[model samples]
Target: VWHKCVDIVTAGLKRVAEIGTMMPDPHGYRRYCFTPLVAWTADLPEQLMIACVSKSASPVTEATHKQFGDSHSHSSRTGDLTLQRIEQVARGTHPWNNLSRFQREAKTIQLSGVHLPFWRNWPFADPSIFLLPEILHTCHKFFFDHVLSWCRELLEDDLDARFKCHHKRVAVRHFAGGVSHIKQMTGREHRDIQRTIVPMIAGCVPPRFLRAIRAIISFIYQAQSPIHTDTSVKEMESSLQEFHAHKDAIIEANARKTRSAGTKNDFHIPKLELFHSFAAAIRNNSGLIQYTADVSERLLITHCKRPFERTNKNKD
Candidate 1:
């Protein structure tokens, strides 16, 4: 329970002088506090945050200082245009990630939140789609690392913290184990699956490449080896670290409350208990440091996959 003035914020003080001061609100402060840990939290697109801060600043001059900032007089023309660029990007990339156009036309498709933003942009729609192989490779490696890391721990409970990669893309992921090899049999079978899944792949590939990927998934589901993805193992770790930091913030807040008010805040005491319970839940879910099956299943089961898979066959 940190008192309001306890200043529990403990991230990116180093870049402070460069990015400019945070807005005077709690969320602004929270976002500012979370900045250095971006590699860890993996939240917000690059450059967009600087844009967000600029947008949030109450007085335009203060916002300008926060944006192009650390530059000469806030009145100067140089900082104005420089700060304006980030806004331009956010505005431009908007359509790339949203699927409403297709859905509105009765496409009636659902893209995963993870892929939705990406699909709204360029490479995702261009069919000439770049990074197909990279995406596959990364997904495969992410699953493999977490699965093996998990298996090792199961075989030897003496160990904790099994993941190794600290990269951004993969660490934020949740990959189900064992599904790596499950494959569809026919081209038609895969075609149907593709109709359903291709959108989730974030429109990040050409039709021809997407077809090829479907073939690969089918073959592997029926075979032994696994296909990888473009996302890195490091990303998964980064996500967990971010999650932990968030959890830690909640814990700190509760601790501060207890100290700040003592008996003065009895009316809201139950809310405090609920907050502690929430923090405990996150702690119980302590993210995997080395990949593991249990964690993988928990993380990978998205909103779409209501009938989640749990095959003990994977252990074999």
Candidate 2:
């Protein structure tokens, strides 16, 4: 159903890409304008759906959960390769020409059974390439979801006490009741927590674990920079490497846990794997700041929420 909706929407885009449209420039001179999908800004789950890759597999790289924590770079996943895999499933013969077999084959390649993706027919649009990183969901949400949870497990009541004791300053959020009591946290709150979290848990967690937290915090801040250079990007990558190096301390402290197995510990986080593509994304698409969802989130409150509130509750 979702793919059908995508097909309906992209049909026009496909036509526009093929037959160029004429538009005026700043000087009012009419010129042929060809629209190609340069970048797609979405949260990780939506990105996986649009790119037709499974959660365990990355759309940007060939790496799966097993290789997610590995420091080595993985081979890129290309549109041509994705299309070819879909084609193979569609044209399978004999024993492979069944629904179960098709699903199994697709799973092996970390692809969903989305045989005909909307972007398949679109010109110069590669899902792997165009699906850019979003800082809000990728960094801020991950911190709250994984990092904060890990810290909470290790620190427990002490964590909250530290936050409660921290002196309040101008422009800084004061979590008077501490983080655990907060029902819902906004992006701004997440940013506020990031600012103070490293020092808040300094003496409580192991030295290696503290280093890991510090490194990830560094990476998150660096990624949000409005301007990025080759040197800056390398520094970002180094921070990620540093985090990966010391992440074992998290497991040793019994902070990280597997939801499925309940006892096993591993760093098979999709967001962690997604970090590997940030350098390439920054180089390909200008700065990471441009891809942030902050502006759009604000616009949602202004354009959607406010208007809905203003509207009368009627069928009309």
Candidate 3:
């Protein structure tokens, strides 16, 4: 059903890409306009859906759950490669002739069995290139979901207590009741927590664990910077390397756990692997800040939420 919907919506996009469109400029001169999908602003899960990859696979890279924690970036997965895989499955050569065999092949390659994706025929658009990094979900949510959990495991109550005791300042958020008590957390709250988290956990955790936290926080801030240079991007890369080097401390402390079993320590986080692609994304699509979801989030409130709230509760 979702794929059908996508095909319906993207039919026009595919047409536009194939033949281009005609539009008038501000001066009223008609010009040929080539509309290609340059960027797709979505969180990781949605990105997986659009890219037609499995949940455990990365949309941009070849990294799967097993290789997610690798310090270096993996080879990117291009639209051509994805389409080729789909074609292979469709062909159903000797081993993959049967349904079970086909399913197994698709699973092995992490294809979602989406024989025809929305962007399959779109011009000048590659999911690996255009499915850009979003700071709001990728960075802030990752900190709150993964890093904060590890901190809580190590520091326990002391982590929250430290947040409670931290001195307040003008224009800075002070967690008077600590973060744990907060029933809901927004991106703003996530930023506030990240702003003070490194210092708050200082001297409380092991040296490697503290270093890991510091490095990731640094990477997030650097990635969010409004402007970027070659040097700045390199610095971001260095910060990620530092974090990966020290991340074992979290596993050693039993802070990181397997999501499925929860019995064993693990570092196979997809978001962490997503970090490796940011530098390339910046080069390909300019600064990461340009693709942030903050603006869209604000628009959602103004355009969707307020309008819906004014409607009657009974499906108005």
Candidate 4:
């Protein structure tokens, strides 16, 4: 389906470019040719496209055949050919066009047989140009949810007990000058605490956690309402870097606890490895992050869902 769509769009763009049929800008300068920059943005599962392409099966199956010395078990060809790897190649980091570790891996996997159809033609000739990191799912959801999880776990008992009777008062005082009102620390109220309240009570949060919180809010606001200037992009990059640093600090702080917990899953807490996508988005098109942000999707769920439905789901 992606292949077909690309073929049709690429053909149309070429035809219009050749015929000189583009609409003029405000300055009345006619522009005929336009290379459509393709970008794919969705939640992590959809964006990663695990097991979506056919080639993912071949190499693993071949490996199994060699190892077992028995031809009976069909090869289960599945491994990590992540979007990050592809995007790295697109951005000139993964060495797809050169000889390096990435190239070596590509060769080992029989790169020629990789079957992502969009990579075959124009416009999508470069996967990096088309498949972008969506800030909404990548940054907003992960960053905020990670922060929310920590906050809820750390403060839920204390806040509920301490502010049992005066929760509304605290919210009213905090947001007195603003239109917002919060009677309970639930859902968006939790988000609001992370965004607005956390900064105000920075002293209460550990320095490492406070820094991460500030970095996240800064990046999200800047992405949603970008300045559309080079400096703004740089600032976004800086904030993202700071967020990553603080995230590392928090992870390090938890490393000892996680180790002692003796859990097989080493990543006991959320990881900020995906934050690289935010930097990629800044480089590709800084201003466009707003369009792909998670704010709208979150708003849709909050507004569209009926009260009864939410109550029933919670009860179940």
Question: Judged by lDDT, which candidate is best?
Answer: 3
Each model's lDDT comes to 0.27, 0.86, 0.87, 0.47
Q: Candidate 2 lDDT, tens digit per residue, 157-210?
A: 999999999898998888899998775788999999999999999988899999
* lDDT per residue as tens, model 3, 1-316: 5867877988888788889899899999999987788998999988998888998899999999999989889999999999899788778743335656666677778987666687877887799999999999999999988888888878889998999998889998989988776656899999999999999999999999999999999999999998899999999999999998998898898888546677455678899899999999999888989889999999999998889888885663
Off by over 4 Å in 3: 26-29, 93-105, 258-260, 314-316
Q: Whose TM-score is greatest here?
A: 3
Q: What is the lDDT of residue 72 in candidate 2?
A: 65
Give me the runs in candidate 1 sitting further than 4 Å from their true place: 1-12, 15-38, 41-83, 86-316
Q: Give TM per candidate.
A: 0.17, 0.90, 0.91, 0.54
Per-residue lDDT tens digits of candidate 1, residues 93-199? 44345545422322111111111222122111211111011112222332233222222222232211111222225424322221223332322222233333323
- Ten-residue region with minimum lDDT total, candidate 4: 56-65
List candidate 4 stretches off by more than 4 Å: 1-31, 50-116, 159-191, 252-271, 277-280, 293-316
Q: Ranking by TM-score, best first?
A: 3, 2, 4, 1
lDDT of 4: 0.47
Query: What 10-residue stretch in candidate 1 is worst by lDDT?
Result: 124-133
